[model samples]
Target: MAAGQHFFGPWDYVVLVIVLLISASIGVYYRFTGGKQKTMQEYLLADKNMSIIPVAFSLMASFMSAITLLGVSSENYTFGIQFIVINISYGIFTPVAAYLYLPVFFKLQATSAYEYLERRFGKASRLAASLSYTLQMTLYMGVVLYAPALALEALTGISKVAAILSVGLVCTFYSTIGGMKAVLITDVFQSLLMFAAVFSVIIYAVIDKGSFDEIWNIAERGNRTDLLNFNPDPTERHSWFSLIIGGGITFLSLYAVNQTQVQRYLTVKDLKRAQTALWLNWPILTCLSLSTSFSGLAIYSKYAACDPVKAKVINSPDQLMPLYVVDTMGDIPGLSGLFVAGIFSASLSTVSAAVNSLAAVTIEDYYKPLYKSIFGKSLSEKTIAIQSKLIALLFGLLCLAVAFLAQFLGGVLQASLTIFGVVGGPLLALFTLGMFTTTANEKGSLFGLLCGISFALWMAFGNPKPPLPALPVTTEGCSSVFTNVTVVAEPQLTRATTQQQEYFWLYKVSYLYNGVFGLLSTYIIGYVASLVINKIKGVSTQNLDPHLFITPIARRLERTMDIPLNTKELSDSQEELNGKYEVNGKY
Candidate 1:
């Protein structure tokens, strides 16, 4: 086979088309057969009738996108196994999401998670959180949609624009028509396909390489198996501190407050079932993460001696997995197509979820209030449902526009995580203030959100120098060598001198800590600001509801202060007793 050529056969194309058809068919089936989505609840929450297994699978599908499938392999191939710490961090935080945050939203029966913000703080706080989520998910959807297309164009010799358009259009069709049901049902199918694709690559790589021991031996020798780096340096990219502490905060932002996961949590029948679904996601997420990490190790084993980067077979680490798929599985007919379909499945599930969530936030948080205030009337259910579909369509187009520009970003995993940290951090802080503390007023929450965003942006893009490119590797084991190929040397860095130390200390923080920094900054600043305001105005915190705090914290405060914390229950009973007294007086 010649270099720079793809080997997709006619059968492969047929298989790809079949995958696309099945996704579209599910949408059509739901549109005609499923009952009409007459209200926001039915349209966005699947009528709150979703079962545990499908919701669990849908949650996994939403969280693990094409970025995880391709980027995780590439990350492991380049940086080693330290990325696995994310799974450990998730294990610790998923339950926090279930018990700490889920009950509040569930008890409130929230359509948008930001609705809780409105009740606890004010409308301004709610709008800030809602808009922040919209921006974050919009940016993320573009990368998710672009990743597979970028890989496909590199491996299959197809047009990048064509791949992006097809993915965006098909996802939009289903999500807009069938609503949440289509997204959920299709997600279950896609999740299974994703597992199959990853398993196939690992199984084939092991068979072709002779044994698992041999693969492990090759990776260990190549320095791809190193796991723990306990270095305490904040600027080091993948240290234990960075991955565990930084990653724990990052996952909290993702699972606890992000609209996508919250929407999934709201779909189940009851709080018990929702909690069960949250716990069930753990094993599935673990399986997927391990599969991708091992697949990366397998790739390293296959190309250990003849690095594709040095051979000029692939341009970037992200392209390595696609090159492997086409070169190794292309001859297997439909197998190559199934793998590509799996990549598309990952992309579609993520983008569709984003579109649906974006639409829900825009209508519920932004549009409904603005429209009512201006017109002095609420929108009918039919009109609101139609508007929601149109909003989904608009967001799909916006995602495509952003996809074209995503090529300029760094690696998929880095870009996605950075966006989550910088955007999601502030939003999570707002929700934390509302749920965890009663003294945080609307002014404090809004101030904290703004400051958190500003600080995160400065930390992320404050430095002027561009990042150094990754160092090159070797291809000494290949059968044939081409002349006139030169490997680029790694760039050297100079120590900072007194004259060069102009930037602030915070500017030097790693991207991994963006979430931690953002969360702490927002909370601290907001709390301090609230204290100052209370001192100046002589405002009292006595009327603030204690139930808004975490249950244990609220209970402890009640016992210490000798105050009643069951305000809602007490108020109901007091009203009933007053009616009895009035009746006795009348007699």
Candidate 2:
């Protein structure tokens, strides 16, 4: 399962210890420098004064965690080179997010990015989206928690349960205390460690494999080519179309609408600088993603013929990749620890981002509403900050429980693939309607959002609930006994064999298609519903102000600090309301 794991040794423990020290030192520094500032904005949004490098790097770190590193590597080990196709699809989404979607929310100066949903649609739709995000992110980070634990358990002989609890608790402690500032800064450190870990694995693979030319030849024969095919077809699964379209929609929502990334953008000086950060992100993330595939290729190149994984038999395919690492990669010393620690970086980045974003929604969307309703007053900034930490604690425990349950599921890739479109497809549709079409008013917004959710939910869980498939009964080092058995005696029940296996291409396509379908369905359905609403009201689309749907960055900058109402731009800024200038005041 692990492709080219020619290196694993006991000294790996020393390497892991050093990496842990580096990670912890950053946690301590953030603890010291930013310990006293606990106001809600400072705690939650990092005071909204961040620039492109820190924020962009933070976004990259968040997306490239253990799930991606381990999952993508496992994918290539099993399915061969097609894993690269799926990830290349994920790479091109950044620019689309910058150009088509980011400006509206930036101009609004939104605290909760989903507040855009509230303004254009209604509160119910907003709450539903935000709440769904919280649940999904919690489940998502839990999966992140579960992945590296698999690797750690295999390498160290640590209990898998212990590994999960350890990582989850540590991440929760740092994220809960450090808030956004801690998440951002720690992410930069994690990213560096991750890069070092990946490169070490690759370098070791280069030395362990016969030679570079020989490795490339094997990979080429295996068809590990073409990182940039555009349509290889949409429904075809992991083709270029699915990756670009599917990845585009998912990252668009992640960058433009999801609060985790949005919170980072808000920390920047202005839209221009935030966008500057956004533009820089694509190449760096593309590199990080490509490294995962490179690790997979190295694994395959090293472990092709007499797969040493046969030495320690495991039922689950997910176990194969990690087992290869411990048994084979461990032949070397510090290298194994660095690679395993790399997996840790992936998981930590994902968990920190998820917890921070979840806490933000809890404080802003849920608690703030309740506080205002009861006190008929606003709470102090300090109270909101305290509440966010409590929310982080509650959700961190919830996610830990989910991580324990994820171990019951199939391989990590399948677990992630299974939930791909459940809510995201519909959420994508609802947001598109809200942002683009004026006729998508409250009625259309609620209807379209619900329809999107129900449709995706139906597809994800409604399909025949797959109780894990049965693997052929086997001993360590499977011998393909079918040939020997057929030679000796006539077969009774025909068995599943090479012919029974699904094609390799589909393995990539399944994940890509779920996302692509969700995005397309939501957009088409929500757009149609908007047209219907416009007809019902006997209203022309032209009546709505164009600026609301198509606001530009330069125009928004010239407005006073306040987000203004849709009105004819007045030549004068002199008008005052109750001793406050209307245009100059924040909404």
Candidate 3:
């Protein structure tokens, strides 16, 4: 309970060191083996030869980092378990990602996802979307890098600077040297530790209390078990409607179109394998999400009467899990270290993914174009291979610097999701406009993306907003347990009673709806603007590329071409359609 007192024992440090060493060694192994990352494809996309299982695990680990581990548990402890309903939206949208959007990227097979935007719209559209993506990932990874620092500072009694530096340096080292191959394999190994960490809390809670049923019952009595809310109001925080509809949009925005996951999907052999990996990721993701949510209840059952935050044992709700581990399980030696290692692994997986993907975007989307514009030629493969590693290293350090600013952001879960929604929604709308409809053009889509981001940012942080009220907590039991420490009196919960009509209506809406607002704003405005521009300019749509659209739309458009086809011509077309469409004169 004193400052500078180390929570980890000797064995704890040993376990933690071994975990970090093993992670770094995986990168080393991949760097020295086969192809040796001599080409850009091998370095960035894993040479398109990865197995399905590792890719699936990597996909889950990349986004569901320590942010989920720390934030979701705190979310359930403070608000309730209603956040678990978002998993249902994941299942509902997995097919959309697998069948619809996955095919477009798979068929194109470009290193950067923004390259699809370039071919579909134009150079201007691609630049706009890619820069938005770069900003989004940088902000999200900054929050991710800050997560482990909280764990370290809480358990080890050290400054956050040490934690952030250790994680950033090691993650950047392995991901930079090992390339995509190392990232995927390390993610698989780290995914196991993530599961171990969450399970440790549940197992300890059962031992500390009597049984799982008692934990659930205690949580129910504490008013944290309410799950069913069908409210249709968009302003409601965690209702079935918000979780299902709004959460589904967020899911599509990330899993369907975001570059981090899309790059993972591209590492596999072909479209079928990629789709299989996408389907497999849902159950793995859902399992971790449900366990993490329950772990919150597991911690809450112990502090139901004597809240740690109320007792001033922890500074914030995010510190509750680490403090609980040190209080109840510190004597178990390696258990506490394993939990911290899991949190570290979560941050490593996410930050590494962002680092690699950001580098890829920079090379293909930004660097290549600038090089061509100034020099009138493409760079050699050797230069690309060398520069990709440097770009990855630079971006990792940039994200590390950004982590210092994450203290200004509030909760880890909301901050990460808010980033996804604010930027990801408009990007998803841009891709959807290109693939699903035939009317959207370059100028309109660029305008729509910029406006959508502006609107979402305003909704998320435009005005000073009230804090979300937590369930009732008390220090009645803490008074008997800690005689020397001062337990703060249970203050009145007044924020919930404040007049809702006082704040701006957009600010009053739930953070979950930010993506939905962005998607609607972009798609509706982009489509209408495109129609207006086409009418005024008298532009014709007769020569658009069929491959730019999805399969059904592309096939229908092929049938509507100007030249009439005989039976033999139709037969030839059927055979070509059965295989793949030509893009830029080659598949």
Output the number of the lDDT-best candidate. 3
Ranking of candidates on lDDT, top first: 3, 1, 2
Tens-digit lDDT track of model 3 for 1-587:
43224478888889998998888788788888946988988988988899999999998998997988899999999999999999999999999899889887877777899888877787788889889999999998889888888998888876889888988888777667878888999999999999988888999999888899999999999999999888888878889999988889999998989988999999998789999999999999999999999999999987887887777776778877887788778888898888899999778878888889999999999999899999999999999988988998998899899999988778888888888889988889999999998888888877888889899999998886756868898778775544355765556768876546477778878899999999999999999888888788876666555666777787777687653223234334644542453322233
**TM-score of each predicted structure versus truth:** 0.91, 0.82, 0.94
Candidate 2 per-residue lDDT over residues 1-587, each given as its tens digit: 23322344557877776776666666666655764556777776777766578788898877567766677766666555555554454456665667556766666566787776665555777798898787667767777788888877766667779999988887777667666776777777778777776676677677877576766676666565444545555334355566566666666666666777787888886767888888777777878777867777776665554333343334345554566556555666686788777777657667867787888888778888888999899888777777788888888888888999888655686566545455566666677776665556656566666666665555554433423322122232224311121112224665653244433332323444554566666667667776787687775443232333445632443353453543323213213311242111112
Q: Cα miss at 151, model 3 (Å)?
A: 0.3
> Comparing 1 and 3 by lDDT, which wins?
3
Clashes of 2: 22
Checking candidate 1 for backbone clashes, the offending pairs are: none
TM-score of 1: 0.91
Q: What is the C-alpha lDDT of each candidate?
A: 0.79, 0.64, 0.85
Best by TM-score: 3
